[model samples]
Target: MFADGAMVLGAAVLCGSASVVLGVLGVRLIDRRISGGGRAGMSASLDAPIQPMVFLFRDGTLVDATAPARALLDRIGPPDDDWGRLMRWIGPRIPVAREQMQQLARLGRLDLRGGEGQGAATLRLLAEDMGEGVARITLCDPQAEHAGIVVDSMSLQAMEEELGLLRTALDQTPMLIWRQDAQDRITWANAAYLRRAENRHHGALGWPLPRLLESPRPVPGAGTATRRAALEEHGQVSWYDVHSHRTGDQTMMFALPADAAVRAERSMRDFLQTLTKTFADLPIGLAIFDQRRNLQLFNPALIDLTRLPAGFLTARPTLFDFLDQLRELRMVPEPKDYRSWRQHMANLESAAATGHHVETWSLPSGQTYRVTGRPHPDGAVAFLFENITKEMTLTRKFRADLLLGTTVLDGLEDALLVFDSHGQIILHNEAYRAIWGEGEETLCATISAWEARIGAGPALAALRDALGRAFEDRPLSGAMAGPGDRLLGWTLTPLSGDRAMLRFRAVAGQPVPGRAELFEAVGDY
Candidate 1:
C-alpha cells in the first residue's frame, strides 16, 4: 500500500507541470497575433491607390510610411532617434502638411490633407486611438487629379521661350550686358561683357557685381538709388551709363549712356561722328575761343589753312597778337579803322555777358567766312566757321536762273498764279496781274479775297479744293478747267504735314503748267 501511494503522487505532479506549460504557450501565440496582424492591417489601408500614408507615434517617431511618403523621406533622409528632434528640423522645411501634423496630434483622432513636392503630391495624415496609449496614422497622395495644368504649362513655356530669345539678342548685341543677384553677385554676363579686361574672371565663371562696379570710374546716376529701386519694384530692364577701362587703349570709355535693351540697337557714337566729321574737315580758317580770348581748339583743316603752330594757340594768347599775325600775312584786310577794331573787341566782351555772337566778313581773295560763337556746357565757347565762297556763287547762279525763267514764262503770253498752301498768292506774273486788273501787291490781296468771295468756284476755289484733297491723301495731283475752257490748270503739291502748294496757269497758247513747268524752265534757261 505504501509503494502504490508513491507512484500515484509522481503521476499527479507530472500532469500539473504539463498543464502549466500549455497555458503559457497559448498566451504567447495570442500576443504575437495581436501585434503582427494589427500592423499588417494598418499597412494595407495606408497602401491604397488613391491614398499616400505616413504613420508616426505621439512622440513623432515614423512607424510606417507609403510609397510617396518614402520618396519624400528619401530626400530629407531618415528620421533621427529622438522623434521630437526630427519633427522640429523637418517641419519648417516642408511648407505644407506641417500645421496639419500638429493639429492631428492635438486631437486624439485627426484627418488632414495638404500639398507636397512643389505641388506634385498631396499628403493626408489620419490618426486613430488604439487604446492604452497607441495610435495608427495614414497619409495620402493625389497629384493626377487637377485642372489648369495645361494652361499653366503653355504659359510657362511661352514665357521661357521669350526669355531665351531676349537673352540671345542681348548676347549678340555690341554693348556689354549683365545681371546680378540680390546679393550683388554676378549671376550672368554676355560675350561683350566678358571681353572687358576688368570683367575677365581668369577661367572662373562669375564674380561680385559690386566689385566690378567699384573701379575709379563712376557709373552715371549711381549716386542716386533709382537703379536699385527700379530693380526691386519693376523687376524689368534698367539702363546705366558706364565708363569702363579698356585693355590696351588709353582712350577711356567716356560716358556712354545707353537706353533700355530694345532701344539700344543704334550706335550713338557712330551717328554723332558721321554728322560732325564733314564740318570738322572743311578747309576754312576756324578757331574756338574761350572767354579770355584765347584759343581753345581748332579742327585739322583750320590748322592746315592757318599754318599756325599748335603751341602758339594755347589758352592765353592776346586778341591783338592774333589780329596782328593775320594782318602781317595779308589774310585779312588792313584795319580800315583802328577804332572799329577796338569796337569789335568791346562788342565781343559785351556779347559774352549776354549770349552767343555771330559775324560775317569777306577777304580780299574773294573768300567769305560766316563765324558763329556759342557758349558751351562747360562755360567755354565754341566757334563755327563756314567758308561761304561757294554758297555765294550758288546764290548768284540761282538769281540768274530765276530771272531767265520769269522772262520765258512771261513771253509765253499765259496768265500764271502761284499760291502757297493756304491759297494766298505767292507769285503772279505781270500778265496774270493785268488779267485780274491788279498790281503785284493788289494781286496778293485780290487772290486772298477771291477764296472768301467765290467759295468753291473755278480759279481760286478749284486750287483750294485740290490742295485740301492732296493734303489729306499723300502725293495727290488733280487738274481743273474753267467754264469757257479758259484752262485754269490747277495742281496740288504737299510740302509738309497738312501744308500744300496750289499753282494755277491759264492754258492758252501753250500754258506754262504747274511748279514742274517752273522748275523745267529754270533748268533749261
Candidate 2:
C-alpha cells in the first residue's frame, strides 16, 4: 500500500490523500455513467496518472486531471472552463506561469518554484509540451506524494461555500487590498488590486501583481499605520489613503480613494494664502477671534496699530490676554477701575457677538481710534481700528473759529446785515436787530426805513442799487437822517463769494482807530 520512496513523502499525504482518492473516484463514476460504459477501458487504463497531481490540456483546454488534481480543483471550486481559474490561483505563487506557459511548446519542459504558502511551505509546478498545441501541467508536493488522508463530503461542501463567500466579499469591495511577506514581497492580492495592476502593467500582469502605491514599506511588527500616496494614470493623478496592518510575519494593506479630500485641502490652503495677501496691504487694523475667544487671524496693520510684536501676535493669545497686552501699552482708554474695566470689556464682547458695535477710544498719547466690532460667521468676531485723530482735530478747530467770530460780531455797536446772492438774509448783528426793532429779520423793511430817513436821494438810491445787485465788489456810501438829526453814514459793499453787506455808522464822531480810517466798520470784522 506504499510507494518505493514513501519515506520522503510530505505532510500533504498525511493530511489530504484520502480526500483526493474519494474526489477522483466520484468524478470517474460520473464520467462512466455519462459515456454509457463505453469508456470503461480508457478510464481503467488512466485511473492513476503521474505526479500524483497532473492536468492534461489539448488546445488550451483541460481534457483530463489526476486524482489529486481533481481534489485540488474541487477545493478551488471552478466550473468546467477552469484554465483561466487555475492561472489566477497560480499567478501569485508562480508569477512566470502565464508567460512561460505559452512558450512551453518550444521549450519542451519547464520547472518553477513558488513563494511560501500556508504551513510555511513552497509549491512547485512542472510543465511539459506533448506537441501539436497539447500540454500537461503537473503540480506536486515533494513532501506528500506517498501519504493519504480523508474528509467527508458535508465538511468539504461547507468549506467550499464559505470559501466562495469570502472570495466574493474580497472581490466585491472597491478598496484595493494585498498581503506582503516579511521580506516585503507581495504574496497575494484581491480583485481590485489586480484591476489596478492590470491598468498599470497592462499585458505583463502575472504572479504577485505589480505594486500600485509608492507607499512606505511597513516595518515588521510595527502595528498599523496610515498614510497618503499618489498614483498617476493617463496623465491624471489619483490619491489614496493607504492603511498597513502588520500581523505575524506578513502585512495586510488597504488603500481607499482620497482624491476628493486632497483637492479640498489644497483649495483651502490656496484660499488662506490669497486672504493673507489681501489683508497685508489694508490700512485699518484687523483682528479676528474664534468662537472660543482665541485670536485666530490678524493683519499686519494690527501689529503696526497696536505696536505689538509679530512673535506675540503669531502665538495666538486669547481675547482677554490680547486686551491686557494692549492695556499694558496704553493703547486703550484708561479705565475707571480694574474691575469696571473688565466688566466693560465683557459687555463689549457681548455686544459684538450680537451684531455691530462701535467705541471711540481716546488714548493718553492723544491718538483717537474709531473701533468697530462686527459679527462674523461661525460665532466668530472681528475688530477694526481706525485712527481718527486728524479728523477730530479739524472738527475742534472749526468749532473754535465759529465761536470767536460770533463773539466779535455780537460785540459790535454798528448795525450790520449780510445777504446771499439770492437776496436771502444769512447773518444779522444784535445792533441790526436793535435798529430794525426785531420784526422779520428781512432786508426790504430796512431799505424802506433808510429811504424814509434819507428822503430818497440819488446817492442813497445808488447805494440801494448796489445792495440790490449784490454783485459789485466796490463800496458805495450815502447819508441818512439820525434820531437827533445828525448825519448817519451808510455803506453798501459787495463781499467775496457773491454776498452783500450793509453797514451804518455815525460818520463824523466814530473815527477812533487807524484801519477804521478805511470806510464804515459796522460789525468791525
Candidate 3:
C-alpha cells in the first residue's frame, strides 16, 4: 500500500510541473504580441514627416518650436521677457493670438490659431497633459494660411491707389473743391481756390471758415442763429458775404457747398472763388457795411450811380459822413425831412445791438431804391441795393404822353411808330394808325411777334436789319413805295441798347426834303 501511494504522488508532481511550464510559455507569447503591436505603431508614427510645431506649456513656458516657429520667435525676441518688451518686438510684426489652457494636466487640450510674424507665416501651439503633473506642448507652422492674408493686403493697397488717383482728378477740376470737418474747419482746398481773391494762400487746412474771417469787420449772415442751426441740422447750401482785409476793394458772397464737411482742405479756395465770382457778377448791386454802418465795398453799378470816390469807403467810415456828403451836394434836397434817412439811422442803431435791419429809400430824382441789410458770418452787415428809377420814370412818362396824344390823328400829319430792333411795332401815334388802317393796340406784342407777322420778307427783313444797324450808332434811311407808286419816307433811330424808333411819312404829295442827312447827323449825336 505504501509503495502504490508513493507512485501516485510522483506522477501528480510531474503533471503539475508540466502544466506550470505551459502556462508560463503562453503568457510569454501574449506579452510578445503586445510588444510587437506597440513597436509597429511607433515605427509608423516615426516614419511620418516630422512636421515643425510649437509647444507652449501651462506655466507660460514655450518649447519644442519647429524650425519656422523658431525663426519667428527669434525675430520676435525672447518669449520669457516682459509682455511690454515682447510686444515691442512682436506686436507690430505678428498676429499674436493669446489663450489660456484650462487645468492643463487633466484637460490635455490645446487651442490653436494663426499668428502674424515675419515672412507672413502662421504658427499654432498645442498642449497635452502626461498624467504625472507634467504637460507636453507642440507648435505648428502654417505658411499657406498666412499667404492669403498677404495677397488680400496687396489688393487693398492697389485699391487705395486707384481711389487716390480718382480724388486727384476731382481736385484738379475747375469747380471749387473743398472739404470741411464737423466743426467747419477747412480740411482741403483745390488749386483753383488758391487763385481766388481771399484764398490766395494754398494753406487753408485746419482753419475754421468763420474764424478765418477774424477781422474786426463783421461777415454777412454770420450773426444769425438760424443760419448756424441750418448748418448744424440740414447741412444745406448756405450763402453768406465775406470780406477779407487781404482782398482789397471787394466783398464776396460765398455759396458753401452742401454737406462739404468731410472734404479736403485743397478745395476750399476754389469753392470760395467760384462763389465770389457768381455773386459779384449778379445784376443786382451788393455792398458790405461794418457795425458802424461804414461801407466796405460797392459794385461798379453802385459806384457809378453814387458817384462816390473809391478808396475812401472802408469798414470804419462813419454813417454821418455819408449822409452829410449827400446833403452837402444837394443830392438829397430835404435831407432833414427825409423820413427814410432817419429810419435808416435808427435801423442801423438797432442792428448794432440786435445785428440786422432792412429798409427802402427814394432819391430826390424821383427814383426808388430797395435796400436789404443783414449781418454777415464775420459779424458784419451786407447790403443789397436795387434801383427802380428807370421803371418808375417810364411808367410816369407813358401816362403823360398817352394823355396828350389822345386826338389829332391825320391832322397833325406827323407819322410816328415805335418799333424794336426786330421791326416789331411797340407803339404808334394816331396818324400812323390812321395811315396803316390798324388800331394802335394791334401793334405786335414782341419783336419776334412782328417778325413773324411781317412774313420775314425782304422789305420787312431789310427794315429790321436797318433798325438793328441804327441802334449800333449806324444811320439808316430808305424810301418805301406803295401799290400805286406812292412814295413813303422812312427813318431809323436807336432808342436803347436793342430798341429802335421808326417813322414813316407820305412823300408823294408833300415837299419832302432829303432827311438822310438829318438822320446821319442824329446818328453821330
Candidate 4:
C-alpha cells in the first residue's frame, strides 16, 4: 500500500512488490505503447506512449504535472486550472485581453512562453467531453524547452527497466528483506520473508513485525543490529546476520541465513558432551590442553589427583597456569631449583610434543604418581596421572618375600629342591645344587629330576621316582644310598597348586642297602 490511502490491486501485486506509487502509471503507459496505442482516438502510427505534460480535471482543476512541467510551471505560481488563475499564472504570455481570458480553456493551441527570453512552449490540448458539461484535458508540448527543460524518453525507459529488475531481485533473493514503519508495523515484506513467517499467526502485512519472532526486541540506538531470530513453531533456532537501517519514518531490515555456523556450534557442543561422558568414568586422571596451551578439558579424576580447586579448573586456565596451580598443590614434583620452574615447564612441553614425557612424582604426602604426557591431533597435549603407590608397595613386598625365602633355604642344613607341575626344577638352594654337582648356571635353566640324577648311581633312580610321583600330585618319602657308604633320606612333599618340594638329609649311619636298612637309618636320624 502506498501512503495517503493508496491501494494496490490484489495480493499478487502486494506480496513481493516494492514501492509502486510512481511506477503504476509508468507501467500503464508502457503497456499502451506495446499494445499499439490502446487509446480510442489515438493514432496507430505513433512511436511512443502519449505522456501528457499536464493533467486537467473536468472542473478545470489542475490534477498533476510531469516533473518538467512542474519545474517550469513553478516559476509563476501554484498551477491551477481556474481560468482566472491560469490567466494570472501565464500573465503576459497569453497575449489575450483580460476580459476574454475565460475562453482560454476552449482554445485548441496555446503558445506559452515562460519568463524571460526563452522560446515559446507549444502546448497541444486534447480535450475529452464527459456527459453533462464535464471534460478531461491532457496538455502535450512538442517544442517545450522552458529554461532547458527536456524529457528523454530513452532515459525514462532505462530507469523503468532498472526499477523492474530491482523489484524482481528483491522478490527472488534468498535473503529475507522487509520494511517496517516507526510504529513497528510490517509495511512491506519480500517473498523470502513471507515464506519464513508463513506459519505464524500474525505474519501477514499490516501486522506488527515483531510478532514473527519469539523474542522480538529492537536494537537500541540508530545504528544497525545483528541478531538471531528463534522461530517458535518448531523449537528450531535460526541464526541470522541482520542489517537494519532507517529510511525516513521506516526501518528496513535484511537478514542472511547463518545456519551452518549455528549447526557447527551445536555439533561441537554435542561432541563435548560425549567426550565428557567418556572421560568421566576413566580411572586415570585426564587433562587436555588446546593449541593455545589452555586447559580445555579435564575429568573428575584430575581434580582428585591434582587436588587443585574445582573453581580454578572451571576457569579454563592456561597450561602453565594449571601447572603452577598443581605445583602449589604439591601434586607434581617440587622443582629441583624453584627459580627455573618455568624453564622446566617449557622443557616438559617440548618433550610432550614428541610423546616422550614421563615422570614419577613423589609427593610430600607419601603418595606416588606416574604422570605421562602424550601428543594429540591439532596441536593438543593430553596428560595422564596414575596413582602407583599401592602397586609399588605390592611389588616391593613380593620381592622381599622372594629374598627372605631364598635366604632361609640357603641357610638350611638339608638340601632342598622344588619342581613345578611340569616336572622342571624351579627352586634349588646351594646345598641342593652342590649335592647334585650343579652350578649357578643351572638356576632358571630347565633341569629334569632325571638330569639331576646323572652321577648319583642306582639309589638315585628311587629318588627320581619319588620326585615324579610328586609332580603327579602324590607325596612320597624314602632313603637312598650315596657314595662312600653314605645314606641320604629324601622326602617329596606336594604343595598347593600343582607344585612340590623335595628335601634330602645325609644319613650319619653306615650305608643303607634295602628298604629295611633305609627305614632303620631314617628312624635313627
Candidate 5:
C-alpha cells in the first residue's frame, strides 16, 4: 500500500511525462481497433511527422526530454531551473500567458502556449500510474487543432529582404548614423563613422560619445544641433549636424558632415578680417550700411570724423539713427526745418542708393566735411567723409592771389598775354583786348598763338618769331608796324614751367620802359 500511494503521488506530480506515453498508446489502440483484431495490420497515416518536444521530471530533477526539446533548450542557454527552463526562453510578447503557464506547470496540469517552432503547436502534460513507487511523466508538443490555418511564408521572406536592403543603404550613405543607450554609451555606428574613426582599436562601441570627441558630451535633445568633432585617431576635425530621436531606452543619432560649410565660414571670416585691416588704415572715413539700412561696418576715420562715441557706433544702429546721432552732435548738416527731417533722411538714402549724393557740412566748430555717398553690392550703401577744411583754405588764398595779380596787370599800360607750353593763349589782360580790339568772342574762347598773330597782321610776324625764340630759352625784343602807322614794341620773356609772357607797347615815339624802369614804376604804384 505504501508503494502504491507513492506511485499515485508521483504520477500526479509528473503528468507532463504521462501525456506523451498516452498519446502513442492511444494511436496504437486506434490502429488495432481499425484492423478489427485480424492480424493487427497497422498502416501509417500519410501526414507530416509531428516533431515531438517534451521534458519529463522525477521528483525535482530532469529525467527525460525529447531530442528537439533538448536541442532548443540548450540553444537558448544553460538550464538553471527545474521547470524545464522553457518559460524563460519563450518570447516576452505574452508575458502574462508565460507566467500563467509556468504556474500551471508547477501544479502538474497540462498548459501551453498554442504556438511553437515558427508554427502553431500545443503543449500537453500528463501523468500515468505505474507499479511501485514510480510514475511516468510526459511533456508533449501536439499539432494544434488550429494549425490547419496556413500563413504565407513569402511575407516573412520579403520582410527580411527589405531589412537587409535598408541596412545596405545605411552603410553606403555618406552621413553617419549612431545608436546610443540611455546612459549615452554608443551602441552601434554606421560605416561612415567607422571610416572617420579609421581604426577598430578605438572601440567606439560601448564607449561614451565624448571619448571620441573633444568634449565629454554634446548638448542632447530632440532638436538638431551642430558641433565640431575631432577624431582622436587621425586628429582630423569636422563639423556635424546631429539630430536625435528617442524610442524607449535607446536613442538614434543622425550626423551629417558639414566640413565644407565650416571651411567656407572660416574663409569668409579671414576675408572680413583682411578687409577690416585694409579699411582701418585708409584716410577716408567709411561707413557701410546693409540692405536694411543698419550700420554694419565703420572705419576708424569714421569715428574721428563723426566725433560720435565708439560705444554708440558699436550698437549697430540703423541709418536714420546714425544720422540722428550725427545731427545731434552737429557733425552732419543741420536741417532747415524740424518737420523736414524725415524727408531729408529719405532723400539722403535715395541719393545714396543712386550714388549721386554729395554735400558739404560746414560745422559750427569751423570744421568742414565733404560727405559723399556711393552704392555698393547687395543693396548696400557706403558714405565717405573727408575733412577738406585746410584744402579749402589754401584754395581760397590762391584765388585771392590770382585776383590781385590780375588787378596789377590791368593797371599796366602795356598789353600782356600769357601762353602755355601748348601755345594756347591762356591768359590775356584787359589792356591786350583794348589794344588788339579783341572782343569777348575772342577773349572768352581759346585762341592759338598762330591765330592771334595772323589776326594782328604781317607786322606782328616778328612778335611771333620772338615768342618762339623765348620758348627756346632765348628772350627776344623787337619793333613791328601796327595797324595805322603806329609802331608796336614787343618783348617775349620765358617763365618757369614751360610758360612765356609776351608784352606789347604801342609806342608814340620811343619804346616802353625797360625792366628796371617798369619795376620802379610798379613799386611807385
Candidate 6:
C-alpha cells in the first residue's frame, strides 16, 4: 500500500510540472512571433516565409493558432474535435499526415511537402512533438505573401477571397437572408433582402438595414422556427415563409416566397365552395367518405334524409358511426339483431371500397329509400340516398288493378285469350284454360289447333284466315263445330294497349255478347 501511494503521488507531480512547462512554451512561441524572430540570425520576414501558418494542439484541443490559421478554420465551419477540421484540410494533400499524426508519439516529428501547384498542393507542413502529448504544426508556402512578422499576408488574401465567394453566392440566391442583433435590430442583410426591402419602402437602406418582416425574432438557444409573414409593395401584398435561427445573442432570418402556394390553396377552397353549392341544391342526399373510412364530406340533403343531427356529422365521424346514427333514427333497414348489424356494416365498407353497392332500405316508418354506394378515386366512397316511396306506391297500385281485371275476365262464361302485337300469348281466362286444357297443354293451343279441334268448316277456315292475317281493329264473328256437334260462336276483338282478345261461347249464351256489348263495363255482370 505504501509503494502504490508513492507511485500515484509521483505521477501527479510529473503531470503538474508538464502543464507548467507547456504554458511557458506557449507564451514564448506567441511572443517570438509577435516580435522579430525566434532562432538566432533569423529576421521577421524570413521567419514569416518559413512559417505562414502555425497551430499548437494539446490532447486533441487547439490551444492557439496564427490569425491565418484561424481564418482557415472558420471557412471550414464548426467541428466537434478542434484538430479534426485541420486534419481534413491537410489529409488529401498529405495522405500520410493523418496516419503519421496518430503515431506522432513514436515518430517524434514529420515533414511533408505537397505537389507543385496552388492551394493545398503547393503547401509544406512541418510537425514537431513537444512531448507531454503536445504538438506544434507549421504550414509553409514559398509563393504566399508573408511580409509581416505578426500576420501572414497569404492568410489574409485567402480570407478575403473566401469572403468574396460568399458575398457573390448570397447576392445571386433568390431567397432573403438577414441577421438581427440582441435588440431585434436588423444588423446585416444579403443582396436579395436589400433589393426587396428597398423597393417596398421606395428608398435606399443604410447600415443596420430595416426589418421588413414583422415575425417574432428567435431568442438565443431557441434553435429554428418557421412561420408566414406578408410584405406589401405598392398596394400589392406578397407572402413569404419566414425562418428564424438564433445563435448566441443574434438571430438569422430567411424568407422564401410563398405566393404560388397561397394562390393554389385559395383556388382549391373556392372550388370546394362551388361543389358544395351544387350539392346543397340536389334533392338526393349525398355523403362521401375518404380512404380512412372517415366521413369527409356531406350535404344538407343527407341530414334531411338520415334525420341525423348536424353536429354529429360536422364532427367527421367514421362510416360505422354514421350508420349507427341512422340505425338509432330507424332510417336504415332493421337488422335481425345487433350482431348481424355490425357484420353488415363491415361488409358494406368492404364492398363499397371494391365496387358499387346498392340496398333498398325499408324503414319501420313505411318510407322506402334506395341507398347506393359508388367507389371513387383514391379509395374513396360516395353514397347516394333517394326516396323511392312515391314510385313504389304507384307500382303497387298498378299490380292491384291488374289482379282485379284478371279476376273479372276469368269470371266470364266465354273463353277469352289475349295476345300481344308479337302474337305471343300474354294472358288467358280460367274458362279459356278449361276449354284448351291446363298448364303446358293450354300453352300449346294455337288458332289452327282450335280450328282442328272444332271441325274445319268454310266459316271456320274464314275465321282462321282472319286470325292469321294482321289483326284488324274491327270485330269479326264466325261459327264452328264444337265437341259432340254443338255449335259455338267465336269473336275476335281488339283491346287496349296494342292487344287483341279472342272469345268463344255457347251459341245460346246472351247471343255471344255483341260488339258493343263485349265492350260494356264489367259492372253489368
Per-residue lDDT over 1-525 for candidate 5, one digit per residue giving the tens place of the 0 to 100 score: 999999999988789678879999999999988776544333233244455565655543567778876776765434665443454334221223434543443454434343333222444544443323223444454545223335679988898799778877988998878766555655456667755654635532212223244322445653334456634345555676666666766566777677788799899989878888999998889998999999888889898888889999889899999988888988866678866977977887899898768988788778888989999899999988999999988888999999999988877779888877766666777666555544232322423433453465555655555655667777788877643444777788888888888787877775554556545644554
lDDT scores for all predictions? 0.52, 0.77, 0.52, 0.65, 0.66, 0.77
Quality of model 6 by C-alpha lDDT: 0.77
Q: Give the lDDT of residue 222 in candidate 6.
A: 64
Tens-place lDDT digits, model 3, residues 1-525: 999999999999999999999999999999999999999999887665545544333343443445755665654423444222222332222323222444555556655554342233455556577554445655555544222222587789899799768767754665443433332334334444433413433422212222322122444645221121122213333222222221222222232343444343327767755665776677566666665567655565555555555555533456567656645555443556667767766666566436556555677766676666667755666766677678767878998887766554323455666665554566665555444434333334433444543445566666656755767676577866532344667787677756766677777674332345334433443
Taking the candidates one at a time, how many backbone clashes does each contain?
4, 6, 42, 0, 8, 0
How far off is residue 420 in model 5, in Å?
Answer: 2.9
Q: Compose the digit string of candidate 2's lDDT tens values, residues 454-500.
A: 46777667766767666765677777655335456778788888888
lDDT tens digits by residue: candidate 4, 47-141: 34544555344454555556645654654333333433444434333333333324445653333323232223444444454434354444455
Model 2 has an lDDT value of: 0.77
- Write one digit per residue (lDDT tens) for candidate 1, span 254-273: 22224554254445556545
Candidate 3 Cα errors over 4 Å, as ranges: 1-9, 12-65, 71-89, 92-272, 281-385, 405-525
Winner on lDDT between 1 and 3 is 1
Error of 4 at 330 (Å): 2.0
Candidate 2 wrong stretches, greater than 4 Å: 1-192, 200-203, 206-228, 233-236, 241-261, 408-468, 471-525
**In order, what is each prediction's RMSD in angstroms?**
25.9, 15.8, 21.8, 23.0, 15.9, 19.9
The regions of model 4 sitting more than 4 angstroms off are 1-170, 177-190, 197-203, 207-229, 234-237, 241-254, 258-264, 274-283, 339-344, 356-358, 434-456, 479-487, 509-525
Q: lDDT tens digits, residues 1-525, model 6?
A: 999999999999999999999999999989987664445446543564533578999988999999888878876535555586677566545556777788888889888877342123367888999999899998876455464445688998998899889888988898899876556656566778878977976764433456788755454556888888988888899899999887766678888999999999899989888988999999899999998989988889998888899999999999998889899989888899999989988888888789889988889999999989999999999999999999889989999999999989877778887776677788777666556533232323575566656666787677667676426768888877664465678898987887777787878743443434433523333
Winner on lDDT between 1 and 2 is 2
Tell me which of candidates 2 and 6 scores higher on TM-score. 6
